[model samples]
Target: MIGSKRWCGVAVFLVLLMAGTHVGIGAESLFRHFVKAKGDCLVDGDQPLRFVSFNIPNLLLIEDDMEFVRTNPWRLPVEYEIEDALRAVVQAGGTVARTYTISVAREDDDPGTPKHVLAPGRFNEEAFRAMDLVLAVANRVGVRLLVPLVDNWKWMGGRPQYAAFRGKSPDDFWTDPQLREDFKKTIAFVLNRVNTVTGVRYRDDKAILAWELGNELQQCPREWAEEMASYIKQLDPNHLVAGGVQTHELHDWELESRVIDLVSTHHYEGDPMRMAANIRAAAERARGKKPYYIGEFGFVSAGGIRYVLDRVVRTPNIAGALIWSLRFHNRDGGFYWHSEPAGNRLYRAYHWPGFESGDAYAERAVLGFLRSAAFAIRGLAPPPVEKPDPPHLLPIPDVGHISWRGSVGAYAYVVERAESPQGPWQVVGRWVDDAAVSYASLFSDESAQIGRKYFYRVRALNEAGISAPSNIEGPVTVAELSFVDEFADLQRVFQMGGQVSLGALGARAFKEDLHRLEMSEGAWVRYWVPGEIREVEIRAFGQTDSLSLELAVSADGQEYGPVPVVQRGFRMNGRDYPYRVPVLVSGRIDRPGCHFLQLKAAGALQLGRVEIRYE
Candidate 1:
């Protein structure tokens, strides 16, 4: 019934299409025209659309990149994250952003990982709804989307998953008759999807610029590309189609194919000379044929990136260039971070407006360049950065742990604390970035006396000015803890043995630390402390099953066994454990540890961080 109303609105828009423009009616009102492909340029009415943007890989779906909070590693992005991402693009002056392809579920995905397509011809409603929000917010924020239909890599469950559905080889996905038809079902579903919020079908959503066939497709044949592109055109004539093949070389068939309207390639050359040459070669080839752009590129110095971007601007027929990728703030606190292992482990996902903490990558300078280049590509001057709005402070569980949903473009924030809800307030922290920490508490107020009550609010800051105070969150009680290990350093580990490692199967490069709790009776890590164990707490990822995890303590480092366990929610000091990735356990255990405790897993699990209150 809800979908019926949405379609009826779409029908009304069609009837009034040639009449005039309308606003505040539905999502279609947000975008009055579709981008058109006209001989090497993409146009919205008369003006061509070019962008110096970045791919928002996790915008529609997420591979939870925070190592400290790593769990199933595959979770759906929340509303806060989706909005912040589109806002980041606007802050960078980018008009278009790309997202990772829809994920297909596979048999061996680590226990809790999520996939969009659970079975052939079936979809995960939760995941698709997350996608609906992406389109809705994109329209509301005035940013355009370039969505890929699927992926070639198994990292996010791609070709292999589809082929597996039919009990065939992964390569069969391209040739298998049943598999080809199965994939078309997905294509038709996406193009016809009605935005639950905007009531606009994806095929008609002006927020979307074009639909790419898949993400950097590998081993794809020209015949397959032509067939799929033709199929997509049949389903949605309102949007242009881009060939997502990962290489610089475009096949003659792709360039001449009537249905394939756009051509793109990914680049990662670190040398300026080679990168420039590569861009020229591709642009020259696509010239006079189809609209061409650099779909993805990065992994160089800031200056190197600028040089490549300059090459893109100067090279004829190259419409735009989207840098490697961008990530946004986490709802619970801080930002979701991902390290690019392919970049020799140097680059991580970028945040907007850049912060000092990101100086290592020259994030500030690079983003500054992107903002100017975004307008420069369109032959316009860059505008001044806007003032930041007040950030929304999350409910504080204790003074030791405070976090907030940061304002867009806010590189820092000023945290103010007060004795009463309405009394004199004092600055507790300044120049604080919600992204300084990943998936952890944003700030810790060490000055607050234990057992004292306080109130707190935070204001966002950028060049313009500090924003007004955010909503007050407090009467927060102060708490303390003696020992906590986030698993970043291994020096604290007294003993270790088993199938566990620092990272997991498909997510090793995410952050450099995170202890994967694999299923093994012998898998364990032992730590030594200097006091008797009184109360215990565990922050973990994955379900609590009979074999999930158990804590064992020993007076001597040689012996270990389970202690009486009492599970609790929230932190012992009244701090709330971040529940975004689902903190798995918190328990009170009795032990005579001359201070040594061991964590063991009898089944697959993920341990975020452990807090032990001891004397």
Candidate 2:
């Protein structure tokens, strides 16, 4: 008899299979379709299977111990980090995820440590177990995983390590008989491995949507990719296979390959129009031959994200699009990989719940576009022709207040209020005519009681109907005698090093009243508290490790001491907010002194606002 764990796995698989059938397009079953490439589109049993996915390359690489392989035989602790990342994808209305490099190497390098490969023909059981857990979690969460077999660059010991094993150059690994056999062995090992947690073999797992031959294997000949894809198909006939090629490597043979199931392209152009145009062109090229996907796209603004998403959703042949990545604070405390600094400054992984980041634009807008597009691609009824932008809600001392940037082509706006974030919300206000103009819209709840929290959201309306609701921002308690310095008027008191600038930007903060303070190693910022302060609350956008802030206070404006505060982060509705860091220095501030506050940061930091509660 199969073990209980195995039975549970099967049970879960069946439930997911049933769920897939229920949600399948055009009243068809996804199980019956199995994501086949039909006439340049991925179809599910006569229904199109269009998807929006995110790249979480380090899903299998647990943050614990960093051991290349699990040396301990016991089940590796299931890291919630991976689940959290997957949750972000799902919450954003994504149904698929494409992970980054899964490396296999003998000796671990500092930057690229934790190689999954112990040696040629020898495999790391621990690393394999981690992947097993990933699939198990993916199954439970109902998100499909598209796993790439190997990397092309040395970052993951792809081609170079294969050659290094047999004393050959990276180029020779493609043609060398021994290297080719070694690669095949690796493929077999992965394809046949049984999951220790779920008790299901990798080949039989339905959670896996596709098997990628390799990531960006441009240096390798088309024949190599075709051969690897064929090899994978032979081992696991159930899942689809992709070459993972970009536009540059789009050869006719590769597109026409019988084994390859999908054609993928990567784009990172700065211009939104150009990126959309490129995707359109690629989709046109792949039409009627194979399904097309923008496998990777990033380093663009929120508008760029919208532009590209619009193009992909409108294209009939394109299967879907996956952003470059999504990062979780619990994983390595922050972004665990190298991202373009410029992109980092503009856009990072779409954080869970809050969706706000240090990026130049609000991710709420991007998420709205993505969620709508995802629905549209899956053959769901299209969302309103235009959705209202997320409203910005702030607590004005002794008053109820909310504001929002206006939506284009919207004739009216509706503001909704609720007692709780997840709530039975009621419409509070509706504005039209001059009131609905962009950046000129504002609402004040005159009856909102002081000291009581409230939540607010906004939606735009046109001739068609009401758009999707904006980002919910509240539970903001109206306070008495609270001095709020939105950082809009504050001058840079001190900038030790790194880039620091203040601006009224980001949808999460008060209108045009946020600051972007970039810090390097050993960098710090000092600000003067406006009045006698009892407590201080700092609002900012940050990932756990990538950007963190330390607050210090001084009575004489000279000697500073660390302030005690508990930093609490939260996720709601597919966005993350590290908002609960409050410094209660009542005694110090009540002493008729303590005027200056200093912030010291170890890693990159973005300072948003500083609020002081006083007598």
Native RMSD of candidate 2 (Å): 12.2
- What does the lDDT come to for candidate 2? 0.60
TM for candidate 2 is: 0.60
Q: Which number leads on lDDT?
A: 1
Residue range 100-182, candidate 2, lDDT tens digits: 65676633444334556656778877777778767777766667878887777675568778888888888897799899999
* TM-score for each of the candidates: 0.78, 0.60
Predicted model with the maximum TM-score: 1
Return the number of clashes found in candidate 2.
17
Q: After aligning candidate 2 to the native by TM-score, how far in Å is the CA of 439 from where it should be?
A: 34
Q: Model 1, residue 431: what's the lDDT?
A: 84
> Tens-digit lDDT track for model 1 on 1-615?
345434533432343232122133233444568999989987776556677898988897787544343445567887778878887887787778988888898787766556788888998888888888888777766678888888998777778889998899989989999999989989988889887877878888888898999988857888898899999889899899999786856667778888899998888877767877887888888899999988888888899888888777666478889998898887777777776767665577788888765676788888888888886676656667767777899998766568899888887999999989896999989788776555667777766666688999999989988899999997886654345555544665678888766533223332322233343556888877666766666665543322356788878887776765544322111011122233446555554544778888766666656666555
